[model samples]
Target: MKRMTTLWSYLLTLLLAVTVSAAQESSAQSLLRSEAPTSLRADKTLSGFGYADRNETKFNYIGTKKDLGSFLSEYIKLPDVGVNKITKISFPANKADAGNSYIIILSEDGNETLYQQKCSIIEGINEIELTKPFVTESGKRYLVGFATKPLGIDDKDFAVLPFDYGSDIEGTSYYASSIVPYPSEDNDTFTLKSPKGLGSACIFVTLEEETRLQTLAYIINVSGTFDPAETGKDITTRFTVRNIGVTDITSFDLTYQFGTGEVKTIPYSLKTKLKSGKTGYYAFDIPAEGDALGAVHFAVAKVNGETNFFANRCLDLPFRIGDTEANAIPRETVLIERFTAEWCTFCPGADPFVNAAVKSLSDAGLRVSYVGHHLDDPFAQPESSQISSYFQGNGIPAMAINRVPQGQTSLLMHPSNFQAAYWTSKLLAEKRGVRIDKIEQTITGDKLQVVVSGVAFQRTFDPENLYLTVILTEDNVAAIKQVNGGANYKHDALPRLFLTDALGDLLSPAADGSFTMTLEGTLDAKWKREQCKVVAFAHDNLKSSLMSRRNVYTAESTYLGVSLANEPVALGQAPVVSAEDGYLSIVGDVDCFELYDMSGALVTTTVWTRLDPGVYVIRIFSNLRAYTSKVIVR
Candidate 1:
């Protein structure tokens, strides 16, 4: 009896010990399951939630009707129905062997529906979508679970279990899946559906704390045009900025650093309840009076508990200002005199070429002054008559470049040669003795006080009659005339005043020394100040004659300087062509000619050496470069 009793006691103790060990193992399994990995919930509710884990036999859950009610009160509001409903479930076909077998069961009160939906999950993240087409009653609740082992026949093992939803729960019930024997880590996704009126909820199945906050930064680009000839200004830098990120950017500051020392800062305010995506523009203009070579930097910071900073850097922009004084005045001054008459027949033909030459030179930074002395011209003055008489000729088309007759030639020529001659004389005369030290011009009422100082070099050239003449010319004058060449001759640089021997009687004594002279005159308002010029020149009056004066020593002068003389030649008029010998030959003293296309562009501006068999416009300028004509080149 004693031996049997002892054996019974030993068996009882063994059974108790076995029960204790099983309980301890079950507790350990639960703890391990609770400590599984998880992920933060995404903003898209219907796209199914994803969580990282090492557990292989784990099932995800949609918050039950009761849990959702508690969630709505504790976390965020529910989403709309369309965004909350799960449309269809899809899984990768290639991962069909990665333990993808499962069943979806719905329970409302005592009514339970088992859905045999198959899934193919890979060893990585697996997505299990559910098409819960049926709606649940108001008081009904639902939950999902994963079984460690196959479910038992009894309902007691399927009861709800305790879980940690990352926070303390008040009115929510604890729910856990049955313990299924599998690996400790896995990845899974779950989708849920709800009624149209009741919004959806997002579930975050995380096992650790979040370490990083959502970060955002932005950059701005700017471009523009700045012309130096238009505005004497330059831009240092340009930039634009906007809050182009998911988080609200507060206390945003933009700084532009152009070159080394150019820097500017601007502060801005941002939205407080900033959502995931929003944008705003911030533009800044560099101050007109700032450095032009600098870089631009942008910095953004969130005004939360601490400053969260984001920054980006950009380069500087460089531009030019306006045209400088040196570009406007390249050479010294040159004086040009256009001697013409109202009754002159061919004078109008030469006007355009002369005017074009003057304009081209002026545009090239060479200061040129012109005078149009009209003789027998309805607008001619006694001074014009005296000047014409001084030349000892009654020629209608005459020009005195720098007060020296153009080789005493009575012919008109192209203005281009005249332009070249004038430039050459000016360049050569810059080193001559007859130098103009300074010319100060001031107008007080009707009188123009011009103080001009002329210094002669120690060595004089020839023993002859040297005379200094000062002539005043006005611009923008209009006149109507009926000349034989063709009426409507518009004239510019009309000479209004002239002075003989303004410096002295003449160098008749042949003195070899230096001298200075100042000349003054009065002008009326009929002449515009901006379009007037004073031309002064010294020449040998004895050597100047009408017929036998073959050797002319007059230098072409500009407002800037003087040029050596080029013998002027008379350009002949176009001859009347006749269809003879299958060729057209020019007649008369046609020293040179040019052919232009119908568009008035010069095609061949050389000597009239060869005439092609085609229609063309022929331009004839005198060797003096004073007169011109247009004819057919055919």
Candidate 2:
């Protein structure tokens, strides 16, 4: 009886010990999430991304290209701990399809693959355990992505949720066709692009932690001026660190290097404790005497005097320390492009907001120009089609501010948001260094020669992607049949001609940052010489950046007859002129009305009999306007 009691007690004690060990293991494990999902799932309605095509051999992918095999990825960041093990990964999937899904990890540059594993996928959410776990190093970025291929004849569709390391955290999701596990890097046919309208692929990674040590820091941002004046001197490079651990951190060890050069370590003690999930700002100096196209890599090596903690380091991309003496360009004009069609009845609803915004912005001491790209209308031109296609937006009455996108994917937005977009794009333009100082146009015989002179503040580096776009738009185009714009509506700012390519002519800035480009074209006989204006601007046309925004740095306009010698007229409020129901109303001070027909014949009559059921232009002459507007009459 005594032997039996002793054996039972031993078994009970062993069971209790095993249970306690499991409880400790569960307590040590915590979920580490990536911020990519916030931006990816920004649109909650979208569940997942994939495609179903009849042609199995042809790889189908969305965003920017047609033939490339796309690999969409998200970014993941882990906290600092000595024993950090990524045990498993989870992703959302459609229950209808089954295939082989791959979990890929790439280095920060997207050039080399650190690790990748393939797993059989199931319906709904797939939680797959990694057969071999991978450990991550501190102060590094890893791009974790999901890819899939058809496993059998029954599996018709393939897709995995996107993963992004949130590099630079520009709220952008990336797609690469040349990266490994898809195609070789030398396959120049496919380039890295962040497609528009597609959000992040929400891929969750599970990490098991084993350490009692608290307090960790991550380098969030690294920035500094690339000014040539600071050459050979220690320029102050700003660093922003965040305490991502549970406990507050008081100090950390920072290490930095420029372009793979010698690494230098610095220990910093903060004046106040940086609380958990809080950020601290610090500044360090890097010698500015190296190559003009060099990047700085920085890492938080230690936190709170502990080396086992995990922290993310940052790699700052190449920057141009401008060597030109020219000052940064001041924003002068905000170009507003409107997409409209005479057939669209709802397009007229947006006219009030657009007109109001133009007037309001101009009245506030800023120059504004409105260009209407009429689609499928009587006045529609081929050039307008190219511009419209470049914007890649559907629906009519959409507006774009300075050719810059208002959201993550498109340059066009509803007209109701025009005023708000103007202010936002205005602030962005002020930060750009490209400026159009002057636009010179001279008429020689039937050909009009245009010389666009500007200062693009890129001296040490070449501005290869920058281009100069010159557009010829005509105002007061009569004889149009509009839907909601009454029986007859005269279109203004119609893009009649494009002297350069629809995109733009590539610009080459001189050593001093000044650039000049000439575009000459024979004026069309149908276009009215007095009503046409020349529009010129400098813009950046990089494909990767175009996914989110197309940076239109600066813009300016000049009338056909205007020369550089002419002084710019300082104007006041625009004349309130309206043409409705065959009646002309002018409300501004010191303005006279002159009417013209489609044939360019001046009308001196007050009789309404001469005005037929066609479009008419009522030109108002006023000193308050640089160039008075032409009203539309039915």
Candidate 3:
């Protein structure tokens, strides 16, 4: 019995020693297993990983053989770290590793005393199902395990699970839908683990009814006075386009037709897109040919291969050729006597009648001259007032025939009838012996000097006080105001300028029957030379008697061959520059010439008359022509 008792004691001691050794061996195995360092951390919840305090419960972890045993003695703190937001998560299908399972653990501290419950991972992404969700007070920590076992099999070969729990939590919930292996019945279930912020929403819609082109047409018309002598005048016509449809019309081209053969195409380049309701205007000018009526038509062509025509609008303009007959007809000078005022209302009624009478007489080979005396005519010139004062007419609508009072007459017919009779009577008498023979005019710059030399058979007027007066007048003046019938009214051919004294000038009729005089004056540059006319008459200073008058003159008032100083003539086209040998020729008329460098400074004035072989800028003014063109000046 003593020997058996001793043997039992020995067996019990050996058994206890073996149990202790096994526990120590298991502890050694747990320590030897690969694990994240104490510095590593993660968050199992949507709140991502970051540094955790050393004392935080979520930071503590344990590694031991027992189901939940502590291995490390002290709590380990993890440094701050972060994981990128997950864009997508993908897994493989039905492969050898498809049925793998994993265990995930998380901790904020490295102490072996504190650890969260393990999470089971399925074949695909197996979101953690939290009984008590892992809350992150400071940072986060996690551990993952992947294992696989077939049905009814105990052998397990766990695949290495990537420790990317921090990556699973995305800041934006709008992550791409992932493709992963099909989950089995045992491990397919998953939870969001923690709530994440919602993503932004988006919406889209379609547009309806695009813009379309509608009917477009160009219409042109010319309406103005026509004269035979002025053939190159420009007649302006207005063009307008209207949008006729409900939709907006965009770009369109306009083709203009002038007469039968002349055609021009104008393109409309619009900066802004036209809306549904809009209209545009185009003003074009057509040059007037001599004695011909011209018509213009417009057609619209759209960008989208569409064309439209509005009605055919035609213009009938009358033009005349040759000189006016009114100027050639024998003129019976009729003295127009009239009294006028600015404040009189009744004077306007008689103005038109007088004007009509003058026009009629003029058309019928008669020359009518008028002296308008005004008491308060607002637009009356100082000269007109002076004439009225010299006549010494009392009351309004008073008149004088050739500066002589024709008895006080209220009738408007008095001036017209008396003046005509007086002129006819004087012409029929034919008692004057002196007659104008010759008159000549020459222009130098802006100065006009006229030389008048004539022969006289009889010298009856006073030689010392005989005065000569030159009058310049223009035809076709519109919108002129005058006084008639005790009122002020508007008329035309109201004398523009009277260059003479009350008793004109002295002309000594020589015993040799010859006389000569020179008249010089400056004319306004803006005056049209073509329409200008010069009239010279003789008057006596003593008796204030008329001697002789003449209306023959020359000098183009419309086309001044020489332009004003510093106001160069604008060229209507670009000049072509040609070089042959060492000489250069510029073949165009330009307003000015200039040469500039790349820095845009005026280098020199290019003299067309003298230039070395080089290129230059020939600047011409006029909208119908180019402003500047490159010309080779050699």
Best by lDDT: 2
* lDDT score for residue 230 of model 1: 36
> How far is each candidate from the true structure, as Cα RMSD in Å?
39.0, 18.3, 45.8
For 573-622, candidate 3 gives per-residue lDDT tens digits of 44654546534455665555544321112345544344445443333433
- TM-score between model 3 and native: 0.29
lDDT (Cα, tens digit) per residue for candidate 2, span 88-132: 766654322343346666665556677787666554445667778
| Candidate 2, superposed: residue stretches over 4 Å from native | 1-326, 389-394, 420-432, 458-462, 542-549, 565-634
TM-score of each: 0.30, 0.43, 0.29
* lDDT by residue for model 1 (225-259), tens: 43231342434434433332324455555555433
The backbone clash count of each candidate, in order, is: 47, 14, 28
Error of 2 at 538 (Å): 1.6
lDDT, residue 247, candidate 1: 42
